[model samples]
Target: MRKNPVFQNEVLGAAILQVRSGRARSRTTLAKALGVSPSTVGMYVDRLIAENFLSESGVRQGPMGRPRRLLTTLAGAGWFAGVEFHALRVQAVGVDFSGRQTTAVVRPLPAEVTADSVIKTILLCVAKLTEAMQGPLLAVGLGVPGLVDPQAGIGLHYAFIPDWNQVPVSSLISTRLGVPVILQNNLRAIALAERWFGMGHDLNDYVILGPRSGFGIAMVLHGKLVEGAHHAAGEVGRWPWPLGGGDGTSQELHHVLSAPATWRRLAGVSVREKLPEDLRAALVEFAATDSAEWQAVCADFARVIGCLQLLTDTEVFILHGPLTALGERFCESIIRAARALAPALATAPLKVVPSVLGDDAGALGAASLAMEAWSPA
Candidate 1:
């Protein structure tokens, strides 16, 4: 069978509009942007409209003469599901055509969430959320907190969710739910969310780093997620550091910079205050420059950032998860230490920003995956 070049062009044109500003462009405008004839652009728009990928919203009155019909992508034509599996909980959200979330649910599990239990909980959540959907779901996106084989939809290793070795998450869920599914690393999902709608909307290169269940990193280069050959590109937690041995198999930094780890190292200190309050207190106490424990944690964070700088050469590094939840002060301390370790890089002003998406990144990324699947054809 032969492929339709016009249809393919239409899909590309629609995707460009969908991702750029979510606004519809006229045939003349599209032609000018795509360097094609107005007639060709009209044909593409007509096909996309016929496929229900786009619709004529109304007419725009130009200065020249008659009003021209404006076409918009139909965001409500279908829906997709996104899920994020974390150590303590599984967060799921449903997104419709316009990239608006329809439903969101979070299910907490034991510290050790078994494979069977995780699947069962996810199915239950899907059932609860999709009860009102008018038709079959389009696709599903799952984010796991470790290495993943995206092509096979399998989780190679989830350090936080032990016993998830080589689990074919996509096939298992697709079999039960009867829909296409995609599996990705949690950190990669975070980077995707940022790239699609968050701080990374304009930037072409950046990195997201922090301690979740364990430390993780995700990079966006040239406006695309840089998943390596085996889909384990940004696994920077294993990088060797001065505080840890060079074997590169230890979770030394995870244990030193994590929320619970930081609190444990502080002995009697409590992080019960709100994020802002906690940050203020930590900043004042650390400013005294006498807390050996605080200094050690900062050093560990700096080591991670230094390695990330040398590796990805990303200008913007976003910090989040339990560590940043402790407060802005903690994040500031890490940034300060990171600057000290790499003086030259700091002098050029490496932006170590906090995560803008927070806990919602996973669900949003999942939605984005679904959107990509259901995009115009």
Candidate 2:
């Protein structure tokens, strides 16, 4: 792809992602990464400077020739928005050029939501958010649960939200808002948030799991995201299981472990809002208690982590979603269970941590996707 003629915007935007990732501080380094000469980088960077996307930070003495001028993004020069809809709720978060969130909104969804309703709610959320934007809105990222074809910007299918099938979410949003858009699975968005803004930023090998709402994973290996065939890499939650049979067949793990579904069943009550920490803590204890159903859930969770450990030597595993509300002790409990049943990999040195972003991870992650769509690396 690099050998082909790259569009000026794509080439420049990719450079911006590199800069934001702290991969290059000077055009010389960016040019090296871009496989172009320093003069060519200067030519394009000057244009970026004119656009207020890049600015001269200072100078760095080059190994040869004159000192190299450092470049940086101007904070708050622009804004991006990310909207995540999952567990029958819609959340939107807006971030400035520096990636700090400036505004956010969350709305509960009705029991029976259709495509049109999802559309209306999303538009309303975006409208409310942009009203507070201090800079131009560059793009929006829409996050949904289940299979997504990012290149096509479509939600291919959703087990929980069947009516959402084949929705061209990106096109609709872009047409309505007059800006670019990116559509992705909510879990992948969470992973990107970790990569760019959260705990996994510095790690090359890590796994992110959200078992509560649904089971999904986003893995970064050697500093690159692992998106399997057709961007459906993280749909492990949908894999069929035969409960302890290990005879090697199972059905959607999400039907039982997803937080909203599981909570309703175990608590014997419906929750209209996010579960309180105390109630969440109680649910944790209940699930950890000695019962076939609860024990099986923990065992299955461990088996899943064990599968990941066996499949790849990921160094860190971060659990997002309701599992986070379970607290660190429970998070570590999941890790311990996995390690106990783990295959004999020479060294599994893995640690499980709770998501620091809390309820905001999804929205912020969506916003991170918007930023990436403009400047993918």
Candidate 3:
């Protein structure tokens, strides 16, 4: 197979980014790490600077010669928009070149939000956010809770938002805003955020499980997000099993483990509004008890994790979304149950940790997608 020459540039760019992120190293240090000539490293750095992707800063004085200029990413060169739509709300965040979030807005959406209404709301939010940015917007990224085709910027299917099926979200948004756009599955986006800025950074392989109004999983292998042949690598919630057998596989996982589901399980309880502290406390207490309902939910999650682990060979599993955010104890319980059911194929210690990015993972990941798209090597 003929290897693309640009692949080498991409590798070098990624290496430079890693160094900038990790230690803010010099060109000589980068050359050492990349096993290349200092002059070659200088050429790459110069190109990056000319492209406005990188900048040099304060010099570090060494004992031998002149002060060395530190190379770093040009964070304010452009802005990226990140949007995440959930069943009940839509979140939009703007991130700068240095991966720092500059603005964030959250708004509630009606149960039956129309496509036009959603698009209008997104535009309004973007307009407001861009007004606050330091530079022109370079790209936009949208994360939807469904199967997304990044190449086409379309959503193939979304159980929660039926109207989103086959929606050319990227083209619609980009055309309206006059900027480049990228679309991604919400779970996959979150997984990417975890890999870049959260717990998965140190691990080469891991799984991110989000148990919210829907259940989804994302697998990262060899430090790259693994989207299968059809971009459906992490649809673990749809896996056929006793809980998700037959037509159930077509249903959203949110219907099984969401707050509404828990409220429904408790007779005469309403989950339409934000759960009260007392109600939250009660649910956590019940989960701690050895009740049939709690046991069933925990067992189902454990089963899902076990199945995913066996299939993906991932060493760490991150539990995310509202369910895990309910409390530390609740998350620990789920972790314990999953650990008990895990297979021995995992040679390294398995970590079932909570997501540090919380609900922002999707938005952050979307921003990252925009960065990758706008600044491709």
Best by lDDT: 2
- Per-candidate Cα lDDT values, in order, are 0.71, 0.77, 0.72
lDDT of 1 by residue, 124-147 (tens): 777876975434587888887778
Q: Count the backbone clashes (under 3 Å) in each candidate.
A: 2, 7, 2
Clashing pairs in 2: 212-259, 240-250, 240-251, 241-250, 241-251, 242-249, 242-250
Q: List the residue pairs that clash in candidate 3.
A: 213-254, 214-254
Candidate 1: residue 321 Cα off by (Å): 1.1
Clashes of 1: 2
Q: Give the per-residue lDDT of model 3 (tens digit) for 308-342.
A: 66777787888776555345555566567777766
Model 1: how far residue 376 lies from native, Å: 4.4
Evaluated at residue 10, the lDDT of candidate 1 is: 52
lDDT comparing candidate 3 with the true structure: 0.72
For residue 21, what is the lDDT in candidate 3?
55
- Lowest lDDT block of 10, candidate 2: 287-296
Please provide, for model 2 over 1-377, each residue's C-alpha lDDT reduced to its tens digit, 9 standing for 90 to 100: 23444576688887887777777789878998888888888877887788788888777887789997787877667899999997478999988886778999888777887777887888899999989988788889887788888888898887667588899988888899998899888887888889878998778888888775677898878977787887788777777764454555555777656766556555655546455544456567564444555455566677777788778778888888775665676666666777677656335676778878777787888899988877522
Q: Measured by TM-score, how close is model 1 to the native structure?
A: 0.82
Model 1: how far is 195 from its true place, Å?
Answer: 2.1
